[model samples]
Target: MNKILIVDDEPNICNGCKLILIEEGYDVDTAMNGSEALEKLFEQNYDLVLLDIRLPDISGIDILKQINEKRLDCFVIIMTGHGTVENAVDAMKNGAFDYITKPFDDKEIIKATAKALENRTLARENKMLKKQLYDRFSFDNIVGENHQIKEIFDKIQRVAALDSTVLLDGESGTGKELFANAIHAHSKRAGNRFLAMDCNTFSPALMENELFGHVKGAFTGADKTRPGIFEIASEGTLFLDEIANMDMNIQSKLLRVLENGEFKAIGSGKVQKTRARIIVATNMDLKKRVAEKKFRQDLFYRLNVFPIYIPPLRARKDDIPKLAYHFLKRFSRETGKQISGFSDDALEMMVNFEWPGNVRQLKNVVERLVIMSDTHQLSRGFLSDHLEIKRKGGVPDIQTPKTLDELKAAKKKFLTVYFGKIEAAFLSQAISRADGNITLAAKNAGMQRSNFSAMMKKHGIVADKSSD
Candidate 1:
């Protein structure tokens, strides 16, 4: 039950409020004066306090001041018989959550108490959500043991606590936003907002309004005022992904915010200031973009205060086994599969294949593998049939031949299986690049359209309906 305390010198007022609040399902306490109220407040934690401004022993403003000094989380509603605007303002200035006159009815008191307690509940829930977000993005969840990854970890450890701008460079699916979240969660402003924006996902005008917000009547269809990410994250962090893809017009405005914490909302003459820390990421070479005149050199310099590069999965093959097993364990529990681990040959196949889509691709593949598995261990042939991964200089396993006849038979089997995998992998890659356009894919591979379609049917690869 929500606890409430009523502080008033009038016995009738205190008793009436207590009875009304108790009927409303509250644990209500009464104090005849400010001193008794303070004693109760210090002795117990109350969700709401209903205080009268005029008390016989002490002033209610003094109690509010003490509450502020001690940094109590309870809400306060001021009550005064003197119904003057000045008294209400005074109460509010001293941190009163609400103000009411002394002649208020039972309905008024109940409403005030309910509203204050509602806010108290919301505050507790907000704190819990922030804790959950911090836990989700904590550095412990980022799995990697390679030396290159360790170096990045050291760099993050050094810079995560700083307010400098961060630039993350990596291919897609390398978890740039994860690094951004880690930085924000470790900073002094962790308790405040942390918002993310993708420059590539928004057009110039929309991006402007989204980053700087707009005032009411600033543009057509902009009926009411909206606060942008910059204003919302003023005391927190704003992460910008695909920073290199931002248009030049928007880049200039962003540069202004970086140079000075000032920006004007769209359609408004008023300038707004934001103290939000900036973190940007890109897959392209930023310096090259600057040289090509596609990106602003000044903005590039401002964003490069701290740079962290995440290597692709192919470059960190040494960590593939650990990553694979990690995904296996997670997917096993999620899919309720009895599969325990991978066969040695299966692990070798995954390690040898190039994962074009990086960790995300590997994760998706493992999820599917666990879902499809019927045995305790994953085998190389099973994985190969599902993955269609073909790499150069790798042949099907064959034992030493007992005689010439056996050798010929082994070569025939090896060539047929190995070359067939290559053909299937080729067709799959072509169709994917062509967006399922079989004719275009066949042309790209320098083959006839009918031949490509036949091969796709033979391999059970579905093709989308696209015009030649």
Candidate 2:
């Protein structure tokens, strides 16, 4: 329940306000003077305080000052009589939430009290939300120990303090968005908005409208004027992902903003300005796109001011174990599982295999592992199913197949090599399990010793010649 303190020198007014608030489902207290109000405020926490500007002993403004100095979690509404309205305004400037004039009725008092308490609730929610964002996106939460990763981390720390444009280039799933978020969180604009948009998610026209909002009647569905992210973000940060896919026309407009920090809403002649920092990301080379005339050279140059290249997972194999365990710990707690750790073989599989999708892919695989686990440890079997499928994925960067015969032949060749690898690994593990005895391995696999020996020889795997 919201508790309110009514502080007034007049006994009738203070007690009457207390009764009114209590009847409205609030826990109300009455203070006959400034000293009494300060005493109660220090002894307990109240949601709202109704204080008179003129008190016999200490002034209401003095009590308000003490509350502000103590940083007490309460809202104050100054109560002033006819000639003391100016004093009430001065009291408000000293930290009172609002002021109610004298000769106020029940309706006026209730409205003021409700408005102050509502603002208090909203302020607390906003504070909690900001804390959550800071905790989740802080640089400390990013798991990486590789040299390239360390360098990138150091680079971000330096650039995050600047207002210059940043360009992040990496593979599709290398976590460019995560880096963008970290940059915004560490920047001077951290207290403001951090808005993001995927350039590839919208067409040229829609993308322009989203970046620079439109005036009413600017489009078919226009009902009222709207502020775009550039306006909404104001002096904060704007992260643009997949920027390479942006249309040429939109790129020109973006270049103007980078050049002069000014933009015009669609269908409006008035020019508006923004100081929002730009951070663009892409999985492709913007320089190459500029050469190909698919992207604007001027805009590409502007965006490439501070480039941060994120290394792919294959280039940072050493960090795979740590990244995997990081995801493991996260997913374990989320899924309510007690997964202790991964097996050595499983770790080897994770490190040796190439993650084309990069860190995002590794995180997803760990999530699945957590779901499939029944024991405290994640075994190699759980990983083999996922990695084997990944290993067989993707084709070589050869010419595109045209004829049906060529497509069929390509498929056949791929499956043949794929099965060969699977067979070799299977045979090697079976031999080791059988203590290098081909006879026992053949018996276990329900195959003849001669057939097993022939298979091992064809695969160039030496057999137990002395045994079977």
Candidate 3:
């Protein structure tokens, strides 16, 4: 049951509200003055407080102030007489939920109480969700002990509090967005939305509309006015992924927003302001793109205000086992599987293989192995065939090879065949996992579709009807 405290100097009014709320299934308490109400609040928690503007001992507005200052988890509804409605409105500005006049209707009071309770419930849920998000993205959750990764963590700690434009530079699947989320979660804007958009996913016009919103009739099929990510993410953080793919015109507009903190919606001449913190991530070298005139130099410098470079999985091989087991545990719980762990040989194979797709590839591989394994522990047999092939095609034993030239020839032959086989297996797995959808396979492998198709063709793997 919901708890409510009714504070009014009039005995009849207090008794009437208490009886009505009690009948509506509330644990209602009545107080004749602000002092009694404050005393009751200090003693126990209440979900709603019906406070009167005119009290004999103390004003109800002062009680409202105390409630806010104490950070009490309760909604205050100001009760006002006919001429005192202005004071009740002022009380609302000071954090009162809604004002009820002296001749309060039973239905009006009940409706206001219901809405306030609903808002209170929503507020509690939002707080819980924010806590969960913060916990999930906390520094403790980032699974890496490498020096470079530790440096990144330190950087995140130092920069998270500052409202600066951050540029995350790294290869795809290096968890740039994860770091971005961590930064936002640790910032003052944690309670607000942490909106993200992939720059490469939309065309120039659509991207413009997505970031800057549009008025109704702005373009074809724009039937309704829409608030863009920038507008919606106001007072929060906006993460732009694959930012190097943003068009030059859009880049110019974005630079203006960063510089002036203002943007005009599409088809609207009126300029609106935004305070959304911009954090951008790019897998490509942005400086190179700027040099090539593909990306704006000004925008590049603007976003580079606070640069954080995340090291790829290959550079931080020591973190592989930890990250692998982390994913294993996560996927196991998610899939309700009880696979214990990986065998030494299986782990060694994973560590030795060049993870071209980086952390994402490793995670996908682990989830696959966990799903496929029916045993207590993962063994080398559970490892990808590519790893086994590479292991078997090792350097030839040259104990009897007397000539240096002959040994060099044997090494070269082994490398050529070994690399060819690895390439074939890698491409085939990517294609097969994508169900022959070349575009999706290329994206998963973090390669251009054309390049992926070329590699597939080099290995004599033809695209089937499923390629569509």
Candidate 4:
């Protein structure tokens, strides 16, 4: 139910307005003066206030200023008996939502109040929709049914409710920012604004001003007072990406803000307080940098309260199939394509390959395939030829397999084709790299010693024992 506050000095006008609003199904309250209205405002929340211009003690403009200074979201509809076109315009400039002339009709009052309430409702709904959309494409959007990916999703949800600063450690293209945004969207301040800043994109001066705001005439472009992300995002979340790239001075400033919730505007004497949640993400080795004294220890501690480490794609190969299909559906709809999905061979190749650029690289490759490939289903040739991803590693001089089938056949038919010849070559290389240690040679191939012996025997390859 919406609450409306009506403030007026005249008894007849105030009572008439109150009766009309109550009959229209509003919870109405009447204040005879500015002091009484202020008291009522402090007592309970109001959706809209019908403020009188000719108050007994306070001016209507002063009331508007007080509401704005308090940063309340209630809409104010000005009621003026000294009604001039100038008065209406001035009321609007002072943050009044709208103005209704005194001795107004019942229809005008009802229509004006309804419109103001509708605008407030729409503004709130828009904010909610943005928050929902942001959370929908968040860390959970990584899209993998594998245990490893599911674990990461669970971690994101678990840490989101806390006020601790999160350090998302992941390789490049691992969707670190997505995780940070997810955390922010799920936090208690989800209704507030979420601001993101890329540390790599700003210089120290611009970054400090952008984070902490500046007073007018603080620097060259100080024509007007400007609020920074921290001020704007107060009671919300601030996501800082590529945090390692930030300058040392800015790092200390960020540390101070996180520690004390206080920062001074550029060239300003006043210190401002922020209650924004900080979520920092980086791909660099902060520990190594800290040991080198290039990164500040205090800032590192403030950011690392809850660290989320994401492994590379190579370590989570089981998730490739799910990720591939997710990206496939996304790009197919985006590009107006009827692509079916990846073929069996394509999935196998993806599982065997190392994704150096991680999830980001995979998403790009899927987009490329969706746009360029003529077939409904993705093929191994498209992945291998277009993406240039190697399914298996070897020397640079090694010849490419004739086809993906040949590569697959190489795995299943290692006995007949490359048995004697390839076994000897592999054994010789392994022995040379391992300095004639059989145990080390076996370990390098991720094979048991017995399995290595069996392979050597099946291929009729001989390795000479070392002479003491």
Candidate 5:
């Protein structure tokens, strides 16, 4: 039950509310004047207060000011027989939750009081959630302790408080998106949503419509009004991932929006403004692309305002051990395995290998080794064959295949080595996995999608089995 305080100069009015509230399971208290109400307020905590404006000693507005000075967390509802709009507005300005005229309905008063309590509860909950999220992914979540990564972290801490356009450049495996998330989390706009979209996912035809929404019947599939990412991400941060893949024509429109913070939706005449901070990521070398005339030079300059380069895993081998241990612990816990730390040999193998696929590949390999290992300790033998290069080991000699003089000869030899059969069986397996879709299968085998087709014809890899 909620505690209620009713303060009014009229004895009949105060007694009536007290009797009704007590009957409805409230711990009701009554006061004849603002002085009495103040005394009662200090003595006991109440959830809601029904205060009469024209009290004998002091007005309700003065009482509210005194209550706010004391910093009590109670919702005040002002009641007055004067019933003037000016009086109601005055009461509202002095921290009153609502203003009710005398002879007000009982249901209306109860509804307003309930709503005030609900608002207080929601306000406290939102504050706590904000605190929790900030603590979880703060600067400490970044894993690397290398010199370059630490420098980047220092720069992030400095720049996060400002409103700047951040450009992240790195290879595909480098964690550019994570850096973008870190920027938003540390920024003043952390409470707002952090929206990310891959610029390459949309085609030229739909790119404009997707970024800036369209109206009903704007095109063939337009059924209703739609809000674009810009509109939805207003007053937030928008991360454009794989920005190098966006079409040339769309780049001009995006650049204009970045300059003026305003853009109109497709098929809409009205202009919309946004205060979103834009962060763009690109794996491709934009300067090279610009010199080649494949990308716009002007747009490149606009996005390169605060460029942050993410060093690849191979460049910072010092952090390899830390990343490996992090992934090892994560994989072990996830798989319900009691895996001890890696052996010295295993650590040596991992730290020496060039991680072409970077941290993502390291994580995948660790998880796989953990699942396959019977013992808790992971040894070098559990690592991938590629990582274990032969050095000064006293192991038994292994048979070596004949060397190939040319690329074609080596490719043919690779097929035989993988399939353990003649050239025909190798071609059959490749084409089969391709589902007769030779280009896709070639890509699956890490070959050029286009070049694979040519190789298939040269090696008799693709054929109509029915014709055979």
Candidate 6:
């Protein structure tokens, strides 16, 4: 049940409001003056407070100030006999939810109470959601026990407390965003917004507008004034992914913001200041980009204040089983599957195979395995045919020969005929799975299209015309 407090000097008004609110299923309390109201508020939390502007001992506006000073999370409605527009405006500016006159109707009072309680509930729910988000991205939630990962964790603990510009350098699919979120969650600004933008996803003009915003008459299609990421993320954190792909002109503007803490809207003359902490990520070598004159050297230096390098999945092979099982459990819960675990052979193959797509590719493969398997245990047979083929280095189901002579003869014979056949079959399956698209086939096989096609030609295989 919602709790409500009615504060008024008039005994009749206090009793009437208490009775009405109680009948409406609220636990209501009455305070005869501002002093009593403050005492009650400090004792317990209430969902809504009906405050009177005129009190014998103290003014209600002062009580409002006290509530704010104490950081009380309750809705306030001003009830006043002197219902001047100036008084109502002042009350609202001081955090009053609504203002009611002396001759207020009973229905109006009930309506205001209900609306205030509703808003209170919404605020509580938002707080809970933010807490959940913070917990989800906390450093402890990052799954890895490797030494390199532990070092990164320690670095995050030290870096998060400071308000420095962070540059994350890593390969594609190395989970740079995950590290970024962990940083923000552990930072002093965790309660504020964490906005992420991909530099490679937008064109130069659109990216500029997204970062710096625009005025009403800024461009042909701009209908009204809009705040950019910098404004929206004020006193928070802004994550820029693929930062090397940003245009050089925009890089200069971003550098200016970093240097002066101020920026102008696209078509506005007014300057605005922002206190957003910037964290940028890139897969490319930024130093190389600067040397080639593709990226601004000054801007790169500005962003590289505190650099963090995330190693790829191949480099962190020890974390493969942990990550694989982590993804398995997640996908199993999501898809309503009851997969127990992977077989020893399956786990070995996964650990041995090179994941060119890194952790992202491993996650995709795990999800696919979970969706396709019917048995509780994931075995080598359940693994992707390409991965199995890569592991065996030839066709699967080959039996070992009894003697060295037999082994040598079988190996030669297998090499003469089975090699070309198995290679062709593998290429055919990849292309067919990709709907005869060579580019996609090569990508799935973790090979360049030219290399995949050359192997295909060597095996006397040709792509279908429909593939074009």
**Model 6, 344-418: lDDT tens per residue?**
999998988777557777887888888888999999867844342442555545478899998997787567456
Model 4 alpha-carbon drift over 4 Å, by segment: 1-112, 123-127, 138-140, 390-468
Residue lDDT tens for model 2, 199-278:
76676888999999999998788889998889999889999988877888888999999999899999899999999999
Model 5, residue pairs in steric clash: none
Report lDDT (CA) for all predictions: 0.84, 0.83, 0.85, 0.79, 0.76, 0.84
Work out the TM-score per prediction: 0.68, 0.73, 0.78, 0.61, 0.71, 0.69
> Which wins on TM-score, candidate 5 or candidate 6?
5
Best by TM-score: 3
Output the TM-score of candidate 1. 0.68
Q: Which stretches of candidate 3 lie over 4 Å from their true place?
A: 33-39, 53-66, 80-95, 98-108, 215-220, 223-227, 384-468
lDDT by residue for model 3 (56-169), tens: 888999999999999999999998989998999999999999998879878888898999999999999989888998999998999999999999989988999999999988
Total backbone collisions for each predicted model: 0, 0, 0, 0, 0, 0
Model 1 / residue 145 / CA error / Å: 5.0
Predictions: Cα RMSD each: 7.8, 14.3, 7.8, 14.7, 9.2, 8.6
Candidate 4 vs candidate 5, TM-score winner = 5
Cα lDDT of model 1 by residue, 1-468, tens digit: 888899988899999999999999999999998889999999999889998888898888899999999888799999877656587688898899998886989889888888888887988887787777778777667788889888887888788788899999987667788888888877777878889987765668999989999999998899999999999999999999888768799899999999999999998889989999999988778898898898999999999999999898889999889999999999999978878899999999999887755777788788888988888999987888656564466666668899999999988867656877678789878977874445678999999988888886554444332210
Pairs clashing within candidate 4 = none
How do the candidates rank by TM-score, highest first?
A: 3, 2, 5, 6, 1, 4
Model 1 ranges off by over 4 Å: 7-10, 31-45, 51-73, 78-108, 145-163, 186-195, 201-236, 261-276, 314-322, 344-356, 384-468
Model 3 has an lDDT value of 0.85
Worst 10 residues of 3 by lDDT: 459-468
